[model samples]
Target: MSHAQHAVPRRHSGDTVVVLALGLAAMVVSMMQTLVVPVLGIIQSDLEVTTANVSWVTTATLLSAAVFTPLLGRFGDQHGKKPTLVGVLLVMIAGSVLAATTTSLTWLIVGRVMQGAATAIFPLALSVLREEIKPEKLHGAMALVSGTLAFGSGLALVGAGLLTQGSDPDYHRVFWLAVALAVMALAGVLFAVPASRTKTGGRTDWLGAFTLAMLLVLLLLPISQGHEWGWTSGRTLGAFVGAIVMAVVWVITESRVKEPMVDMRMFAHRPVLFTNLAGLLLGFAMFTQFIGVSYLVQMPEDVAGYGFGASVLAASVVYLLPTTLVSLVGAQFGGVLVRRLGARVTLAAGACFGVLGFTWLSAAHDATASVIGAGMVIGLAISFGYASMPALIVASVPAHQTGIANGINSISRSVGSAVASAVITSLLASKTIPLPDGMPALPQESQFTLSFTIAGAAFVLVVAVALVGLKAAHAPRTPVLRKVTQSGTPQSAEVEADAELV
Candidate 1:
């Protein structure tokens, strides 16, 4: 049968179950992305390591995810998404168990590296939805899964807080939680998610994958550690230069290869390019809110004069959690908007909301109400942006390339986030108020103002990218031919019949 002739399966209760299972799995994997944030200090003390050394708990995961996500994604496209997904989950489970059982910092970092493989889960899940779901239900399902990712980051913060509440706390408790979630997700996938029928049969692009991984590592390593190494340090500067050189070689290699790991031509496509660009900016905006709000609220009111002095738990519950929950609703609404208005409009609207939120925080961050309210607005913006991204990608790429395309987009977001972390840390650290005696210095209030202003401007750029760049470039084009029925009436069919038959 022709690809188009394959029966589109009817929607069933089982499909909903699959969506939930996948969404939950995505959420669980996403939680690992930020699960170490709240307990970094505890881990430092417990492991007898410096803050710089301890930071690798998060950095190792970031680097591992950056290196592996695209590779595994392409592997899924070549082999099978379900098996790749299952294998990734099992690895994540082992990672969690290892972390839960280990006290050595090296072992913990290894475990985090294993957990980083979960990054593949997001794109793999997106590919699966495209293959399994009816066309009519795909957008909404994608939205829920995308939104759950953002939701899971916030949920992880809260979970970390709850896990580390006691005076004598163990960081391993958090990994144990990850183990439970991974096991559940593993079972759900094994039982509910069907085997993959969509495959792009080809030899794996080892040379291309290796070059791409090196480029990502060189690029992300500096971004994650630039603050510590000094932005102008030799190591940081050298890595950036090396990454550029590697990228040039990778492009040449990919052009020569039979089946490239990442189609460089896709980057030239206006829709794909602009969508990835927007993903980067939106990712930056989202993390600014995430890391910014969390830090802003935790500043000691007496020392900083601008903070509410909330604990990690308080910040998670009172400030971030509500925003994340609202994002879930916003994602559903965004899915509806995509179905009705289109992805460009939804993306532009989200960027506009983000501008408003960041602008509010920039100008009026004195009160708790204002901070939380701004967070809620940005939360909505995040959901809308996240919901629209995959839809735009899927619309632009062929089904066979869906896994790697989405994977690239995911990496774009990660790069944005890494940049934001470095920028925010530098900005806040640049201007600090000295405290008396033994008290640690605090960032000046102007620093927060400046940071928020920068974020607001970034959102403004997102709006411009969405409205100007995305609209003209990514808009759907008209088909070459019109379909006609036996009655001689034109029908809006996707495919054209042979002229000879007619």
Candidate 2:
């Protein structure tokens, strides 16, 4: 038998079940990450801390998630998938328990950091699904997983708001609930996931992993905290310099290593290179839509904002419709879009949708109608964009590197989200404008207006990249020349032609 046939057969049912469960778990965990946003002010008052310090509750989780996701992806690929997943779930449960029991903000932030490690669940789950699912079903399966990530955040926001708004405002209950979910998810993953039959060999590239970690820190740190740290301060400059040096060192070290942590050579392919670059832009652009819209929906009315004071539940319900509806629509139609227009066309269409959505948002005044309408438009646009981008990444990478490649793609999203937050946060904090005597605070409205407008502009840029640069990006397969050794007349010619086709 050939080597390919001799290889172990896929466990399709078990793999699909594990992926479905992981997708659900990832969705819940993602929602849990942001559940505290609506109640930050209340939590601050009770904990007797400044808003600045309270913000750490959110930032800590994001930072940790971004830093560790790629690490987990690499480890999962090197060792085995199920063990890594179990470890990640255990870490999340520990974090939830710590956060639930702690009254101190310090401990809460610490727990959040630990919980952030679970960020790997989404990418890891995708890697596993890609490995085992039939090629025919892969597209829909990935779409489902991606949609869950987007939709879960919206649901969590609403759920957190509802739980925290009750009498006595139980913020701690949110964390406890997350813990319960994690425990159940752990049990499901352990019981349902099949153990790997593939050989688990080779020592992990510790030095390369460390260097890449430093590289990510260098790249993400300055972008995330530059505004708060003073853009021109030593901290920002040092991070920039450190990122440059580490990146260069990383290149040299990875090149020399027998087993590189990340195979940088993957970028040698034009399709892989440009697809990731576009992914980065899409991330930078689409993430801002959520931030701008969420802020608009929650901001009080006197500030020229929607004044929704819409409890978290109400706002989330509104926010979710766009994502959930579009996701379902996208999953159903993604294959048709791919078959008809190709991945490049689909991405461009998504970006166009984002551009129009953001432009419409920019024109809307701070009203419930505007916020909900904008959410619908932006969510639908992102649905097509998110679902297609990962499929393209999978198509471009080899099976063995699936985990690492997708992990990097996930990192692009994280980086983009951080950039959006930094920009929006600065705009909200620093900008000021005069207001009419009876009108709302001009500064607040102006910030939202400008930020949304800029976000629209960012989406337009993404469209430009998709159209101009990504139009022709596809994998380049080498052509192997073959000759027919037979000395027959027409028969020799036919044999040579057939060999070339192979």
Candidate 3:
């Protein structure tokens, strides 16, 4: 509620326009996470690179986001959101252009690394919502924007499938689409979103940023590559141990710093902490739904002993689109729910939905309707879960801590995604369908059931985190609720006195 927490100025643009601009930017960021999923094979073949080298296309993005999101998010809090957002968007555009034109694996990976930084846009957009939107309408706006993360991720799969459908699949088309999205997002932000009116001006915590970046790199590197590197191997185990050591060092460094990049108290605050735990579980469930369902449907029924014999396009459009649509629609309602029911109830509800959806998926994925319906239900869970994030964050921390607090939350989810990706890959590979000589083996049908079961378990833990850890927290402080002054600013009382939730 402090004056320093300005997202964008309301006087410069309508709330709708500003929200849309941030949402578009966030959507583009989400797309970067999954843009190359369907095109990796083509990218490998066309570039004549080894499978291991081509895989870096995705890993580079994963590691890059882990390193840069927190750094740039804190940078925005210190410098100004407009410049930070503009810088990140420009990087995305340049990266997209590089990726679109690249014929070399090294450059393609470099491009992906640049694109990954756009993930910082989500936290920045949320912080902007905190400063600019009134509390009365803020939860809804945050929910709508947060929902884009899920919708955009799903959209990438469908789009990638269509763009790469024909025999001569042009990998460049995928990056070109990214360029278009980044351009539109950049335009929306530049034209509609106003500059920040307030900033938490301070010295950059370079040491803390470095330590945190190193921690994330140590953690995510293994999760993303553990499948390729044996789980028991020295490199994988050593990275995990190193992450633990770096985490302790990062904490000590932050504690002693003059201007700590992240506030340890805020990082460990119950509501913020548990909300991030919920975020991790949601991330796991989401990837589980996407990777598990996609891989399941694509299995050749006759040869694989179980599956729909679905093509990749059919998998994306028929099975997954319903989920994406629900994430959009459910989010609007989720915003309303967060306002009426509180973040605790909203998150627990989302977890309940996740349990239901995953149970259905595990028990009855024999028919197409069952697959699509289960996914849609899970999408509702994602919508509600995402909607709860800003509410919890805003309520828990001061306005000055908005960007860094949310940045860490974003990192938590990224970590969850990395773990889920590694777990799923290892699980599916653990038990494969037997095959004739020279033919590749498909995953055993039981692996899908097991994956869904494990995902449901993650959600169950989210329910506990929401109900217990977030039992009571403060409400978000807003500016004066009564009157707008002539200068388009609100005449306000003390921010702490106006706290809403309790």
**What tens-digit string does per-residue lDDT give for candidate 3 at 1-502?**
3233443444524899899899989889889998898888899999998877898999999889988998888888777788899999999999999999989998999999999999999888987877777667788888999998888988998899899988788989999999999999999989887777567677889999899989999998988888899999999999999999999999999889978898786687777778888888888888889989989998988898778998888988899888988998899988888878877789889999999999999999999989999999999999999888777876777665678878888888888888899999999999997788899878898999999999999999999988887776553222212222222344242233214432
Residue pairs in steric clash, candidate 3?
Answer: 7-128
All candidates in order of TM-score, best leading: 3, 1, 2
Q: Which portions of model 3 miss their true places by more than 4 Å?
A: 1-13, 475-502
Error of 1 at 213 (Å): 0.5
Whole-model lDDT for model 1 versus the true structure? 0.84
Query: What would the TM-scores of all predictions be?
Result: 0.93, 0.87, 0.94
lDDT scores in order: 0.84, 0.69, 0.85
Best prediction by TM-score: 3
Model 1, range 100-166, lDDT digits (tens) per residue? 9999999999999999999989999998887777666777888999999989998999999999998
| Model 2 Cα shift for residue 330 (angstroms) | 3.2
Q: In terms of TM-score, which candidate is stronger, 2 or 3?
A: 3
